[model samples]
Target chain A: MSDKKISTAVIKRLPRYYRYLGELLENDIVRISSNELSQRMGVTASQIRQDLNNFGGFGQQGYGYNVNHLYKEIAKILGLENHYSVIIIGSGNLGQALANYTDFEKRGFVVKGLFDVNPRLVGISVRGMDVQDMDQLKDFVVENNIDIAILTVPKTKAPAIANDLCEWGIRGIWNFAPVDLQISNFDVVVENVHLSESLMTLSYRIKDSY
Target chain B: MSDKKISTAVIKRLPRYYRYLGELLENDIVRISSNELSQRMGVTASQIRQDLNNFGGFGQQGYGYNVNHLYKEIAKILGLENHYSVIIIGSGNLGQALANYTDFEKRGFVVKGLFDVNPRLVGISVRGMDVQDMDQLKDFVVENNIDIAILTVPKTKAPAIANDLCEWGIRGIWNFAPVDLQISNFDVVVENVHLSESLMTLSYRIKDSY
Candidate 1:
């Protein structure tokens, strides 16, 4: 609609809306009112209407939203149609697990390569891709047009590797490292996955429920 | 603090504050003002004050908050010292990876055992713990007094398995399964780790930045 930038909170919620709409689409649900969608999503109906309105109303005044159409629009906004060439730095347990995760392939994130510093792990194959040596990282990224680097390295090593990845022109980072990465100057986008934080939140919820 | 219950938004942010304070404690930073914490956490100073005030004012007038004191308080609120015994269902790549994740142990979650339906994987060891047969899951959980079950099973099998876990008296579930579990008439807590959702959010952020 307007040229105004979307708020970060709205941006964060778009994926959730996409996921819920996808489920509705799969279940052959053609349309959903804001109230119905909000009930399923555990959010207020007014909030749902406000969020969708930011992206040019996909819903009708009374008939509500077309599930398939809304899902497509959200997917397009999320860049899910753009096939991103991704590489994992650090062939550790988390790295290998993510490499073996088949869900990414269906969502336009292709794991092109996995890199590691350990020589023993270097030549090893993970999910049909050989773990390339760390020395080959820069060249591999440059040649393969890898835009995303998934960092699962140890906390001590994460910062240096993140810097290296950024230097090699990596546009995005999905960092699972314990420490927050320090990338100041670059236009790179980062998504930090702090597993402990999630667990802590869970613990709090469990405690609160009791 | 008033008798009013803390909102879910404030509950979700407690862990992040705990984490930031932990880092400050590690760095021997004794005290931090709300403004300083807000800058590092990317939140407004007033928001930080409001969040902290929900628990009880940890900050003093003019004199900043003590990092160690705040960290301990948050950890207490999160029930981190409860020592929850955890079991992983489905010893696949994700399960094994999480089993080997040593971070959970430090945060009071102990990985007691891993389970799988595959007979071949039953006798196998993951992160030094033997993978148990699916039949042994209930007995193992009961014997160990397990509180949390990590579901890494396939999407199709997730709902049934989650139901089984809940029926067996499991208190909390850290679900990595793609499908959202439908559990009613139970006191169980669930925290879904939707990997695709996270990636989609990242994709949206990247797309928006460009």
Candidate 2:
């Protein structure tokens, strides 16, 4: 593998490629060319090569790439080997739902805590975890060493909550709220996940397909 | 405005651009150049111009673009003019949270129905709407003319649910499950919103930022 780092965009697509490759591997796929992978990903073959080249050369000229090795390499680059301790802010429906979601554990993310501003929700158990008071966030984060914060709070409170999350030493944030947040001088990586934006994109796709 | 349609990628980014423009409009930004928009969007200036140009010439050579009009035009093209009926499959924590998510109403999508296979949850009212049995999906879709289906079911059940949704004539699906689904000829748009993928991306970003 090359010493040069790959872009975040390329890294983001690695999970998708990895998932596809997992399926292919399960189906006994030993080798695959860039062209075939590109077709499956709905991207150009050259683009696939370029993305892979950023991490290092993958396939040879004639033999294509080894499926298992490619999967492992991608998994390593994505930091999927370690269990990520996560906390959900807002303890609302979204937070509680995510806390209960079984799929995260399979993907190397563990929900360690759920925090909320509402006193009524505090001490309530969702899935197996109790809803902790938002005031205890710093203590919980420091105690558990939480690195990921899932921002499922309302739009009005998202920014302030995000700031708190960063201050509490959360390294990454998966923002479900629609608001944009700004944080400085911290290693916090914020990824905004907008439901409306995804739905709107789907609507446009539906209209276009017709 | 030119008659040529924009690429799907550009179309998806239009809403993001519109959101930024909305902020600009609130601050009384009357005109914006492509360079400024590109900086805000994290894309190339020429790409911004190309995306805007394909829909129609919104940018002037030296004068830039009118923020208010551009925002409205993009909104209209994305069909945000009217509210769309939506059905959420699997009335678990995630589905209930999405049902209670107020942002959907703000973005012209209404969660009218919540469906589940569990008998206990079937008659329960969440955020003022009754959770219907999965058996009623076909009728509910036909009567309400559901344009969107939010699939929050388990991965194994996603494809079966998708099949039922397509048979009921639904077009767009916001898939929360981590499975790839294939739907036939009915303009099915599945937007895979995998939490694991998002988390892994966040992990990569955190590693890179340091």
Candidate 3:
């Protein structure tokens, strides 16, 4: 199943499935049919079945899927069981918020450090973690097995910082900067969280509703 | 074009197109072929054509699309020119970051106020806007004609706050809460920014790269 080719669309839906299944697990639901799960997820039942089948169908012919098993399977597929050591590249408000966000720890992403170029912010402590100077980033990455770097720096600074992170051996980047970081030459994987794009999406929906 | 029904997938892509076209406009790229635009966007030329055609075919048969014209069209479709008066429901780190984010103003979303239940946070100023009390939310919204509510409240408090916003005649909600808001009964539009989902997506991309 891991070797099987999965479409980007299917991959995108995995987190939603993981989330819904997590909710079901919390509710102590033992099993659920494709129909029920699809209804809950606002997707078609057949589409749900097709997506699950992409990763070797966990659902049975009639008994449906075991909620806990399915959730665990999705979690494993998402690499949530493998704890990731993370660092925030910018100690701005968003970075600070993310560092304080305790939910990441429950899902295996442990933020190790926060870094900033601002002298005023360098000594500040956020959520029990002291902000380190950007100059120390490479050494810290080498010392700590940093799996991901969350980029929250200003747009002007994002590209250079992203390049530095890549050169320093960061495996993944969760970029919150407005600019798209072009560092494809390195082996680093990136996920750009364009907050403005999300806002535009919401605006479109609002306009459509009218 | 406005009357035509657009799929959610196409609607989602509009922002990406808008962003790309904006960059092109900045570079003074007046006209671009579908193939060139497709290469830049990582989508098929035909798909790009299809998307634009859905919105009245902004591109010519041979000359392709006029960058500035295309961008303005997308902006119109997204309702970006119409200024939306917004308020942040929580003044936490994320909320503060958003309130201070000046880019949204350029995109036509004006931050009217920030609201909080905590007495300590209320009356505090953020990005020149005073944090208003939660009790004053309804009156403020009415007086200011607030169109959107940015929900950065705790997950436990999100649902009730969302319901309250909907009842108070808010047209749209940009939810940053971790929870999947269930508010279908009301006529309000919602766009949930599940930061964890984005993290999971990044994790998956990293795992796949490995």
Candidate 4:
């Protein structure tokens, strides 16, 4: 797979395609034309063809995309086959929620520990995993080979925790904190889920309709 | 504001600029050159200038952009001044998290009701609001002037609930369900937060780093 040459835009769209294909597989749909997929995804058929073409043109000339094959290929491309040790920091509602989300576990992100600075949250069990103290984070991350840390902490605590996570050899940071915590000079990737921003987007879109 | 012609790509970047400018305002910084902001945001200076230019160029000649002015303008453009009544359709961990999340309230998205179909979850308290029955959804949404419905429901239930919410005059959907629910020929806008895809993106970026 000559994936290195693919654009970031294409890479982002791969997951959506992967998801849709997964649904198709579940429904026992063997193949789908780009036009059908385009209508379903609200994207152009040509765009789908072009994106798939970037990865050696997975679509057959007239057959469109093979559901099972494309599903597996996308999963492989997105590194879904590789299992990652995950930890949820900040045992708040959102943290516990992510800890409870079985979808992440199904996609090869295994939650090994949940941590928090608050003593009330520490030692509380969520989804069969006990909430550990922040004190245990460094050792737990290093020893267990934790690959990703989900930051659900408040804005004030996020940056320092992200920095420490990077230093502790955590590879990826999935940030839900309101603030942007970009840690450079380390082999760390930060992906933020800014709920506030998403809400603002909703407001922007529906303001005229209202 | 003649914002009708602005591209969706630029609209997506506005929240980020709004947030960055907000931090600048909080720090007592009244002005910023696009170059200075580009360094912090990892955006090109020219791109920042072009994006803000779409909103009538809030920058000053040789003096750079007025942070407070840009912040206010972005807020207005993103429709942040408007208060929106909201309801959560799933009273599980994710739904409860959104209910407890203070940032949504701060941004004027007030959660008016938390609802679920599960018998055990119904009438439970989450952040002062009682989790209501799914049977109450239609009436509550209609009478409460609810502007948005956050669908944190399971995958099987989200699409049907989204359809009902649209029918009940709910203006927007912040979907966390794995499924894509598109309601056309209606006054509804969907903003999805697919945690699984985000995790996949993180995996793709850090596959070699690990």
**Residue B174 lDDT in candidate 1:** 94
How would you encode candidate 4's per-residue C-alpha lDDT over B121-203 as one tens digit per residue?
Answer: 99999989899998888889999989899998889988888888888888899999998886863689998888888889999
The Cα local distance difference test for each model comes to 0.86, 0.82, 0.89, 0.88
Please list the residue runs of candidate 4 whose C-alpha ends up more than 4 Å from where it truly belongs after superposition.
A1-4, A55-58, A61-64, B1-4, B208-210
Question: TM-score for model 2?
Answer: 0.84
Q: What is the C-alpha lDDT profile of model 3 across A57-80, one tens digit per residue?
A: 679999898888888888878888
Q: What's the CA error at residue A111 for candidate 2, in Å?
A: 1.7
CA deviation > 4 Å runs, candidate 3: A1-8, A30-36, A53-64, B1-9, B28-39, B44-50, B53-64
Which is the better candidate, 1 or 3, if ranked by TM-score?
3
lDDT of 1 by residue, A1-210 (tens): 466677888888888898788889889999999999988988999999999987686789999998888888778888998999999998877788899888798889999999999988999999888999989998999898888989988888988888887888888999898777878735888888988888888898888878
lDDT of 4 at A107: 89
Give the alpha carbon lDDT tens digit for every residue of A44-117 in model 2: 99988887776566788998878888887888888877788998887877788888767677768898888888
TM-score-better candidate, 1 vs 2: 1
Native contacts matched by each model: 0.76, 0.78, 0.89, 0.85
- RMSD in angstroms, all models? 2.9, 3.8, 2.8, 2.1
Candidates, ranked, DockQ: 4, 3, 1, 2
Q: Which candidate number maximizes DockQ?
A: 4
Q: Estimate how well candidate 3 is docked, as a DockQ score.
A: 0.78
What alpha-carbon RMSD in Å does predicted model 1 have with respect to the real structure?
Answer: 2.9
